[model samples]
Target: MHSTMERWSGRVAVVTGASAGIGAAIAHELVKKGLKVVGLARRVEKVEELSSSLKSEKGKMYAVKCDVTKESHVTLAFKWVKENLGGVDILVNNAGVAIDSSLIDGSTEDLKKMLDLNILALSVCTKEALKSMKERGVDDGHIININSVAGHIPPQDYFCMYAATKHAITILTEGLRRELVARDSNIRVTSISPGLVKTDLPPKVVLQVSPYLNPEDIAGSVVYVLDTPPHVQIHELTILPVRQRL
Candidate 1:
């Protein structure tokens, strides 16, 4: 068994935005590794379908219909995890959104939505997960942020606000790390920056990049980070396709 699989087996993990895309991929991988995995998303139907499909895996999967933007919903979700799966030992903050809106022409609603999901919701989830872990005395917990390349460099015209949110994530991850260190906590935090992954892209666009990455690639990295020894921390990792210009 892999280091992570060995250490994390039989533990609980909560993954957000797990209806599809990167979140789904991460949830699926964790389920196969024998961790009781809870998938949180607003689209319960889609997550339900995924649950049934993954039922045969080594571990178990439960679907929690949640709206990350709402604090009430996020609170209910962590509560559900506690009531059902006990507590979380790992949190994959994988829920994110990227809509087409520029700084100059952006709708207030659109920008607000992006900020809520991309930043606020993520912070709420982290806070809740930490509470659960602490309640259970899980000092060796891990938190993985599914950040983007835009967090490092703002993309072209239409992605200014999105970039701003990602930049905040970079700081958030580092800030959280510092706090954890100051408290002398064993909980580890890591951030992954993936460039141009083929999530909702068309086959034509995906094929344009000779070595474009898939959701599975990122999922594999998540496992790698968690698999490390308790003392080792993979602070930040960046992955990109060979053909990606940016």
Candidate 2:
């Protein structure tokens, strides 16, 4: 086993949006590293299906039906983790959405949903995880936020608000890091930015890119960041496929 991974064996991790795509990939990767994982998503049956099939892996995986946008659900989800699986050693904030709507003519409901899931939900999960880590004195816990290339550049192809939400994640990652520094804490925070990943995105959104990255590519980055020694924090990771210009 990898040296860093060896230390995480039997530890607890919470991965949001784990029903499918990059979120599901990250959950699977971590469980393979021997970390007990709780996969949270609105459509948790998918996670349950994946979990049942992962019985032979080094560590175990479970599902939590959580709608991250709701504060009550987020709180209840973390509460269940505390009461059941124990303190969290790692948190992967991977729930997000992208739509094929321009800000100029987009439905307000669509824009609000983007903000709720991408920004508000991520923040809530981070807060809940930090609360558990602090209460448990978990010095080496980590918080990983899944960002995007859209976060670092101007919006394109009618994803302006979605890009804006990712930009918020970019700043949020830094802000959380600074807070930890001020508190003299060892907990690590990372933001992973990947470009043009091929997943279940709408065809309109998918048509704009070529040679896209696979979800596993992003999941691999999550493992790399988590597999680092405690003193090493990957503050921001931006991955773009060779042929992807954006």
lDDT of 1 by residue, 135-243 (tens): 9888999999999888998576687888888888999999999999998899999999998887763246545755668899999999989888898999999999776
lDDT of 1 at 183: 88
TM-score per candidate, chains pooled: 0.95, 0.96
Alpha-carbon deviation at 100 in model 1, angstroms: 2.0
Off by over 4 Å in 1: 1-4, 201-211
Report per-prediction Cα RMSD to one decimal. Answer: 2.0, 1.6
Expressed as tens digits, the lDDT of each residue in 2-23 for candidate 2 is 4586898999999999999999
In model 2, which runs have C-alpha deviations exceeding 4 angstroms? Answer: 202-209
What is candidate 1's CA lDDT for residue 170?
95
User: What would the TM-score be for candidate 1 when compared with the true structure?
Assistant: 0.95
